[model samples]
Target chain A: MQYTSPIREPLVLQGKTYADVTEDICRQVEAAPNPRWLGAMFLSLLALGWGSYTLYRTWWYGIGEWGLNKTVGWAWDITNFVWWVGIGHAGTLISAILLLFRQKWRTSINRAAEAMTIFAVLCAGSFILMHMGRPWLAHWALPLPNTYGSLWVNFNSPLVWDVFAISTYLTVSIVFWYMGLIPDLATIRERAKNPIARFIYGAMSFAWNGSAKTWARYEMVALVLAGLSTPLVLSVHTIVSFDFATSVIPGWHTTIFPPYFVAGAIFSGFAMVLTLMLITRHVYKLQAYITLEHIESMNKIILLTGSIVGIAYLTEFFIAWYSGVEYESYCFINRAFGPYWWAYWSMMTCNVISPQFFWFRSMRRNIYVTFALSIVVNIGMWFERFVIIVTSLHRDYVPSSWTMFWPTYVDVGDYIFSFGFFFTCFFLFAKFLPVINIAEVKAILKSSSAPSVIEKEEKVKAGVKLTPSYNPKSE
Target chain B: MTKHEETHKFLVGIFNDEDILIGAIKKLQAAGVKLHDAYTPYPVHHLDEYLGFKRSRLSKAAFLFGATGAILAATFQSYVMGIDWPMIIGGKDFIAPPSFVPVTFEFAVLCASLGMVATFLVSNGLLPWKKAVMFDPRSTDDKFVLAINLADNKKIEEAKIVELLKANGAEEVNTKEIKKK
Candidate 1:
């Protein structure tokens, strides 16, 4: 018989049967778009239009259209790049790390989170191209055989490492996400009455039969991918950190960047997940699947990661002063008291102080508080990147050359474009795909459903007790 | 090549629950009846062991693919940077293995993930255009299905097999003929 801990909160509520799981998830995919979805899509398209126009002007007039000056060359572009890339981390962590740990709650959220990873990575990648000014020559980033005067991409460069890391991360994430979607796609294909829908889902599903032998191999593939992805996810951000840490700049150069960046990435990522999931839970009416317990578990992670980030912040300050490096010490002091002090303080307040509220269990579990804090945390994360990129570059060793950076319209528009792009992709995915893994949720139903619901079920089917004895503590 | 069609016959048993299905499999095996295959909406743990299937070797495949990627990356970087056109930048050595670690690790993971998934899909006969031989479509929905091939179990009478399925809590017993390519 299946056994779950007595004190453990149920991951799935209302004791949903396998059929009910299928029906509830599939109903959203099969139904036509609701007014809310359409309205959101329209707003996203409008932002995308404005972003596209600004992107065109920037490309046409060259990088001069951006607010970047000689003093602060890498301003909003790199900040957004780092922020979005950091947001992409939560999906793989949810799918790969949580799966390896055998967290059944991941089944409800992994699909959407992984989808977010793919889209967020896409948004992050666009910045790399946008910053290049001439995106058409993007092929030069690849280590192709020297066609231009016998010069190859420097393998030693951290920028070169980013190309490999980001591309590999995106490809593997898509393969992993699509592999998980096949079985659910087959379920949708079977239920679709329209021939067009049937053919589309059927082809996408690759005719999965769900045979015991196939499932065995499928599970094996999933496990191995998860194993590979765990290290890959960590490595991707580490390489991104290397881009800054390898530089000789006082504020940017630090040994603590890799771990600090990773912790911050997960912190921001879980916040973004909470932001999207809270809305998704409401819109799709998936409260039974994504319960408060799931939110609490994610909040606990945010609390842990946020504290780690806070500690990292203090450690950076301590090292700067303790090492007796005047440049490094001055960098830290200037960040807090300089012209960009508002941005730095905002980062500290939003990222460092805001998440501390989650220390209280009630705040962690409250939906409205969680939702507001999630957005606050993301705003803090964005400023964290801005503070790191802008504050460091705005004032360097040459005091005469140091100047404050201001954003042009293109910078703001380009940022809005990513929102438009991300939400557009997410809305389409939610409408067409099963936002939750139907099969995985079904697999956990017998073991993780609420005990009280099961007891009620047992009473309805008298003399047929799924669990031999119902423990009162399960309530 | 000309297309060829094949017809296969089987006794399909429909089960409402996975627990009852597992129990039925054990009982049917004790009756000395050879089974074809079982299908379910979700994974049924230990069902493979009850069916006496061997452990999957996809992990080994992943390891081999990963090794190939590491070797390929190390060799390619060494050949290009050390021998082909070495340029000393930032006063670093011509051959730096430490710098190669990030790309090598990333490529290894990339190769392993893509290769293993390809192996899985190919081995399982899952392709976008491939036609599926389904005993019952409900197996992909909410039902558990167990099929016993008539040709594989020639000694067992059809009537006796049907009776065994019913006695072991199968909700329905039916015959299905599947066309295979």
Candidate 2:
């Protein structure tokens, strides 16, 4: 019988002092010019100017300058809104949900994922604010009391709920991410040579001292906040789901929305994470920290979430027919075979069929394939939102109100700017923050590096004791 | 005081599984031995209750911090947008609840998070303390340890400790005695 010792090292990578790890990351960042710096800059510039021009046109004219009319009151604008919201989900899920599950791989990827959630949500808000015919008058949607010109805001409106949800999610995320960064910040603070770098990291570190007691309490607090973040993350998407689920549109209102929307969010979110991570791994050359195993794990999540979203599509179709409502049935049928049939099929192919490749180990492990699939998944999710909003709203109750709505140049430009916003923030975050948690990684290393004296002594003692006890048995 | 005057013994029984550790703690509790501390690399569920820990008041911290945020945000928004400036747009009232909720919730969460972090840092005395010389670095890696100081209880003797640890399925026994120079 094997007698197992109680004391052992579970963390695989340990003993990497803050200096070693930070140097490694800095060295990587410094040595590489991001390979595509010029390209990224050029594209970003092109998109920025074009996106600015698009907005300038929209502001100069009106929201009416685009293709939206009465029946199809929402078009690419709301579609982008939902798309960005869905994209935001993957980050929080990686950081919070994976943390709860004790998935160690999450440590490598969560910082970037959390950053993505914040930026994507911001991009999403841009859509809603821009969608408003009178964007400046948007403050009226808020609830202030009378006399001070404060009016009671209706809690019933999903838009009102959204003001709470997105704001809460972003703030909570900032705290969670910052807390994780504190120890790492201290690490960077210690290692930094330059005055500016030293000051920046020092302020961010907030005088973090790596004491045992501090770690105990910090871990406790982090776990508790992680617990709080879990529900908040789920709620943000569920509330976003409610925007469509609560509406009276025949196709929009459904019981499956909350879970379905959540699933779709994760699917799209993972794809974006993979896409960025793929570029980052190549750009910064962080192959060791962001390993193939980590990519495989993310791919697994993408597959699972994608499958869940796929099942939702099937369920929605079956239920639409099973419920036997003509309008609902027609909505589903029109989605599959309507004027926007190409868009609907594209969504299905990108979301459901494409992710199926991850079932193969080769595809999941391949950086290029994973990166390509992620982009496909993102595009598919965007179209899914478009189909849901445009198909239902475009062909509503009255036939005369039905019109094919298309995106104008302004619509297209904002779409490019949305990427501009996402990439710009992500690039800045990568350059500044410890993208992979340094302290947690260091803690893991410190524990794993040494085989303790206790274990060595225990082995010696066990050996001394065993000689006497096993004599009879051996004889 | 004489240095290294050997007296009583602390028998720390080691177990591979969490369930076994739990059962041992319960036995120790039942036998009325005051637990010095139990250290595990990873958190074991409900091990704290076995060791007789009170519920953490981080929740209270969260609540207080959250309330501070709510009040501060509300006051700020009310003062800035509602009373002080009073910029009216689209005939809509100022001091909007929806707008208030965002800032309030943001501030609340912010306070709670910062409060939790700051309180943790201060309470733990973590700011660049004298480096805690490691007792066993491997403890953080993957180990469950129950520390029993022999001097803590008069009832526990050296022989009895060894017997108890052996009975509780300890893999090995070793002694650590503090020396006074």
Candidate 3:
């Protein structure tokens, strides 16, 4: 057996064996939903309903029902769209980038983060559909052959790039997430007691046999997908930033937007992961699998990315002034001191200032503080998008066209609607799927040897049978 | 009976610990035992190398698929923009390859990923409706089961194989007759 310093912390606490890992995860799926899960689901469904109702109203009344005007054309919809897309970055970062880096700490949280990526992208995609106004004509974004004499989508438009980018990101993420779930799904299929459960889980499992050859191929496929996804995730947010940077708007016209947006994306993505994971670990009582060490490690990432984002914010300001472009300088000045100064300042406080608290060990370890700051970070990111979009567009060089934009009820409703959509999917995902990746967790058990494994080893030495007695009663 | 209709008997050795399983696989291989297959709850890092399995061809397949996707993306965009409807926007040429890049990149990734996963599934015979040869349910949960097909060779008795397994620290030994489907 591999020996290390006794003081070193294990990734999985409580000395769990391979069997216990399977049991712990399968037990979550096999057992009936507890009151807490039911409560969260109930609340999520209610919000989903409310959001759907609001969206229906928007559909009924048309785009005029929104707070949008000629001047501030893109407001909360685009902000929320960008924000959701950015939130998805953490999942890809955890699952793909960290996989390539061979970071073991990621194994505990990658499953949930990947799921969050899919759901967040779903939310982000829906906003674009709604933002298009004539959702029926949304097919125009695709490069499909048209009835009107060979008309094609604008190849030069970043918006068209977004259509391809978002769809491709969503597809590859689903495939990656589903591929990772196969072995665990097979495990669930075998453990399932109910016939219905067996059928569903079995189909989802794709009849995985856990053979050595299959495992080898599975790893190869996973590695290849991860390789594909790393560049794909970076390009996704870069394309998203292109939506703004390609525009003639002074503040939006910057070369640094791509890397800045990417960094901010990872920052907000990690923050969202922390927010969800903290609650998930608490709610599911999975402290043994998702230890404080995991939380601390994630916090360190947040601090790093958050600082990069802060520097980006400062760089944008310096460049705006350094370029000696009057309109650009004025745009930055107006953002910090003009009509929407509050939004700009909130973005700074949340994205730049709040995450710095993670520099201290106590702040990183404090769950409540981390949770609160995560929400603050998300709030800041939303405002960051808002400050970039509305503030830049709300006041233009033509002072006659300048006007302060405010969100109508529908605007607020749409934001809530997207959150409801996000949460509904998340709640369902949490309940149905193994929130933790069981197979990956099993692989790490040797290193993260829970105390129980040590005790079980002792029992085996004392002549206790190694094969766990099969319980037909449970079956 | 024809080979297709014949049922194969497998001498299965179940191991709780991975270390013991690896040792047994090495010992069995050294003893000139022709192994059928090994099943585990999770992927063992160097098990395949120890068992003398060939390296996977999935990466080569991924590269070909990715190249196809990239070519398709570039060709499709070029045809649409340059020939079909050549309306100029942003004062750029209709066949501006720079603008085609994002779509091309996305398509390449999408194709490469989906193709590789599909290849993996098909290669493993793990389609949704396919039947898996389940050696033991515990293999998916906790046990590492090493199965040797008795039908393939008649040189060794079942008892001798069982003894070999037990002596090498197998938690349990059993005979299971698996049908060739």
Best by lDDT: 1
Model 3 bad stretches (over 4 Å): A1-8, A450-456, A459-475, B1-5
Summarize candidate 1's per-residue lDDT along A1-475 as a digit string, tens digits: 4578967878887767778899999999999898999999999999999999999987898788899999899998999999999999999999999999999889999999999999999999999999999999899999887656667889999999999999999999999999999999999988989999999998999989899988888999999999999999999899999999999988899999999999999999999999999999999999888988899999999999999999998999999999999999998998889888898898899889999998998888899999999999999999989988888888889999989899999999999999999999999999999999999988888788864444655676796645423243422
Residue-wise C-alpha lDDT for candidate 2, range A201-311, written one tens digit per residue: 676666654432345556778787877677777778888888888788988999899899888988888898889888887777666567666888889989999999999
User: Can you write out model 3's per-residue Cα lDDT over B1-181, one digit (the tens) per residue?
Assistant: 6655778889989998778898998887777687888999988887777777899999999999999999999999999999888977888998999999999999998888888888888878889897567899889999999999987657877787788889998989988988875
A-chain TM-score in candidate 2? 0.88
Better of 1 and 2 by lDDT: 1
The best candidate by DockQ is 1
Candidate 1 ranges beyond 4 A from true positions: A451-458, A462-475, B1-6
Better candidate number, 1 or 3, judged by lDDT: 1
What are the DockQ scores of the candidates, in order?
A: 0.82, 0.10, 0.77
Candidate 1 chain A: minimum summed lDDT over ten consecutive residues — where?
Answer: A466-475
Winner on TM-score (1 vs 2): 1
At residue A304, candidate 1 shows an lDDT of 93
Question: Which residue pairs collide, candidate 1?
Answer: none
Higher-ranked by DockQ: 2 or 3: 3
Q: B1-181, model 1: which lDDT tens digit per residue?
A: 9867777789999998888899999999999989988999998887888898999999999999999999999998888889888999789888899999999999999999999999999988899997667888899888999999888888989999999999998999999987643
